[model samples]
Structures are given as C-alpha cells and as structure tokens.
Target: MFHKEGHKIIIITFLLVVAVALGAEYLIPIPWLQVCIQIPALILLILILQFFRNPKRHTPHNDDHIIAPVDGKVVVIEEVYEKEYFKDKRIQVSIFMSPVNVHVTRYPLGGEVVYSKYHPGKYLVAWHPKSSEDNERTTVVVKNKVWGEVLYKQIAGAMARRIVNYAKPGAQATQGADSGFIKFGSRVDLLLPLNTKIKVNLHQQVKGGIDVIAEK
Candidate 1:
C-alpha cells in the first residue's frame, strides 16, 4: 500500500502524468513520438508510487530486539562517540536508503522520547563519513527500562531536501511504528550501548519494522 504521507504528491503526480499523456496525444501530430513521451511519463509515475509504498510489516514484540528503522543496506557498524545525547562512546549502526527504498522511518523499540531535535545542515551523500554529522538531520533519543537511552538519527542525502520527524520530547514511542519519513534518499544512524549485540552485519539488506538489527 502507498504511504499516507505521499498521498497528496502521488495524486498530483498521477494527474500531471495523465495531463501530459493527453497533451501528447492531441498536441503531437506524430503518433510514435507521442507514445514515446507518454511512456516515460507513465514510468516516472510508477517509480514514484513504488518509492512511497508502505508495505504492512508484522514486527515481533520483543523488547530486547531492536528493529531496523528503515529499509536499506547496512553500511556502518562500529563504536563511535555519540556527541549529541549520550556524550559517550556507543555502538553505531547505520543504514543507507536509496531513492528506490521506502522512505518511512520507524521506531526501533518502545520507549519514552527523551530528546528530539532537528539540525539543518549541508546535503552530503548519505554514505559519506561526515554525512551523519554534517547533513541535515533529526536526532531522537528513546529511553526504555530494557535499553536505557537509544539514539537514532535521520540524515538527509543530496537528493533529499525535506526531513519529516514525528518524535518529540516526553512522547511515547512505539516499537516498529512510523516515526517519520524522508523524501527521496537518506540514512539512519542508531546509537546503542557499546555492549549491545548486533544481529546484522555491514552490507546486509534490512527491512524497516521487520529486520532485527540488534539486541540488548
């Protein structure tokens, strides 16, 4: 199914595609050229629809497991100094989402949102080492009895200009539930305790709200 956040854009795109096809059919005298132009427009609409699709996922209700926040390939898994919320060393797990991947972001686990902040910055490539710190991003920290405080960030890539975040301080975050959405391409960084057991490795493909990325 398509995501609710994309309903307006999808409808607009659909109407634009239909208008273009009709214009080509009536305005273009050459039938072959009209077909060629309409075909590309139709393909573009299909691609956009596919990008915003929010497939239903049944997340296992395990408090110890941390579900992936977005559908993408794991790019980084290492210990890094989490300078934002924790201000200490933590294990960092990063997933890189391309234009074709679903742009929806989900909460990794259920908890009380302790911190939520947005930082506007440069639009660097999502995979770049500095992208997590330099790119436009939103930082969200969720605290639970099982996992303490887990920090996750949505970093905008070169293609993404808007980052929508639903997290706010003192709000309850449900595990594997929709937390936000990023337009086009982006990356998500999860900062967990250094001793947390990682379930996935670098380069592994993950599905948001489906794949378990780590465990306490």
Candidate 2:
C-alpha cells in the first residue's frame, strides 16, 4: 500500500498528470511531441507512487535485535564518535535510500523515545562523508529495555527537502512501526552501543523492518 505521508503529493500529481496529458493531446499538433509530453508526466506520477509505497512487514519482536529502519543499501559500518548525544564511540550503520526505494522510516526497535531533535543544515548527497553531520536531519533516540538507548538519524540528501519525524520524548515506539518519512532520496544512520554485533555488511541490500542490522 501507499504511505500516508505521500497522500497529498500523490493526489496533486495525479491531477497534474491528467491535466497535462489532456492538454497535450488536444493542444499539441505534433503527435510525437504530444506523446513525449504525456509520457514524462505519466512517468513522474509512477515514480511518485513507487517512492512512497509502504509495504506491510512482519518484524519478529526481539529486544536483542535492531531491525533495518529503511529499505536501502548498507553504505557504512564503522565505529565513530557520536558527537551529539553519546559524545563517545559507537558503531554507526548507515543505510542509503534511493528515490526508487521506499521512503518510510521505521523504528529500529520497540522502546521509549527518550530523545528526539531536529537540525537544519546543508543538503548534501546522501553518501557524502559529511552528510550525516552536515545535512538537514532529525536525531531520535529510543531507549529499549535491554539495549539501552538506540539512536537513529534521518539525513536528508541533496534531492530531499523535508524530513518528517514523528518521534518525541516520552512516546512509545513500536519496533518496525512507522516512525517518520523522508521525502525523496536520503540516508539513515543507526548508532549502536559498542558491544552490539553488526549483522549486515557494507553494500548489502536490506528491507526495512525485515532485515536485521545488528543484535546484542
């Protein structure tokens, strides 16, 4: 099914496509030129439909496991100093989502949302080495019973303009449930405790809520 975050854009796109197609067919004298105009309009709508498509996922609940928060390629896995909240070393697992991938952001694990904050910054490419820190993004920390605090940051890429975050302090977060959405292409970085085991390798394709990223 489609995601709730895309409802407005989808409807507007549908209307625009209809108008453009009809306008081109009746107004343009050249058949080939009309076809070109309508085709791109149709393709734009199709891309929008696919970008926000959110499929149902049955995530096995486990306090020890951290599921992938978004469908993407595991682009990074390394121990880095988390300057914002942790202020110490943690294993950072970054997943890069393309415009073709599902843009819905899911909770990595069920827990109490202890910290959630937004930061405004430059729109760098999702895979940029400094994008995680310099991009427009939101940082959310979910405190699991056994896992302590699990931090996930949604970083907006050059194509992304808005990063919608539903996380708030004191709210309950369900594992694999919708946490937010990132418009267009983006990346998500999960900072786990030092002892957490990395389950996914770099460049591995992962389905959100279905693929595990790490474990206790």
Candidate 3:
C-alpha cells in the first residue's frame, strides 16, 4: 500500500540517519565523533515514532444529511456573524486540528459546487477567532436539493500553510468525498442554515468523511 506523504516523513528521516551512521566510519574514522552522532540519532528515532503515530478513527455509521469535513475537536459552536460569504448571521461550527489529525478535507453533503474561492492570509493558531478570517482558507459552496446551499471552509494554522482545494465552481461533489487536503495543523468551519440541527458540541471530537454535523 502507498502511504500518504505525511506518514512517510518519519520513515524517510529514520533511513537518512541510518545512512549517516554507516558513512561516518568511512569518511571520518573518529571514535569521539561516533559517540556524538549516536546520541542524537537515538533522540531523532524516538521523535519519528511519535510523528508517525496514527490518530484514532471516528467515522460515523450513517450519512443521512450531513457529515464531518475534517477530523478534530470542535472548538466553536454558536450563532455568529459569518462575514466571509453570506454576510449574515449563521450557525458556525469550527473544528481545530492538531499536528496529529488527518488533514484531508471531505464534502459534507452531496451536491454541485456553486462557488469556490481560495484566500491568502496569515498563519494564526487554528483555534483563534481571527484564524477563520485571517488564515489561508479555501471556501466551497455546494448546492444540495435537500439542504439548499451549504458552505464549508478549510483554514490553515500556524504549523500549516498549504491548502489544497480540488473542487471547481461547477464540479460535482458527493457527501464524504475528498475535496482537498491541508498540510500539518489547521481548522475547518461549516456554515449551516439557521434551522439545521447541529449534532456536535464544543470540544467534541469528530472524524472527517463521517460524524454528521447537521441534518434537514
């Protein structure tokens, strides 16, 4: 199986260290320097193990009306002024992702992409209030028959910079289908209709491509 590049980072680091260890004997042939190299090599190996650890999966069994766009803890869930696209009051649910969380984004509902935009901004912390507005983000609006129109955004955080969005203005998107990917840490915001029922709460952990966030 092909591992995601994020998963392979640790493996590549380990191999590089091993190669350096073997090359030291031929190049330097110094006993004192070998001990120095060995100590740091052990430390790096431990860090690689931690970086490669898989987060617990939390996929929901059903997808009736809504699903999670990304995996992480819900940081904000309340009625707020959504100034980005609608410029009106809407229910905003924000999920904060740590470095360990899967950064891939999925469509929350099956529909045709109505609009899509990518913004360039600052790398604020994912949980910060300004992060959603100030951080680099990609906005996708999907038109669903049952849900009407829904908008979801992928925002980059301090450790994350690249936001990969695949859906175009007229693309077809299925519920739980891959829409894009964010590197490292980030956040996602789901802007829902005022009457849509929110199923998750603050600090509640949710899984991308699963974990329904709302329903008709």
Number of clashing residue pairs in every model?
0, 0, 0
User: Model 1 RMSD to the real structure?
Assistant: 0.8
Local distance difference test, each candidate = 0.95, 0.96, 0.80
Candidate 1 C-alpha lDDT tens digits along 1-216: 998889999999999999999999999999999999999999999999998999888887788999999999999999999888788999999999999999999999999999999999999999999999999999999999999989999999999989999999999999989999999999999999988999998999999999999997
lDDT tens per residue, model 2, 135-197: 999999999779999899999999999999999999999999999999999999999999999
Model 1 bad stretches (over 4 Å): none
Ranking by TM-score: 2, 1, 3
Off by over 4 Å in 3: 1-18, 21-64
Listed in order, each prediction's TM-score against the native is: 0.98, 0.98, 0.80
User: Per-residue error at 66 for model 2, in Å?
Assistant: 0.3
| Residue lDDT tens for model 3, 120-180 | 9999888899888888999989887787788889999998868889889999987777788
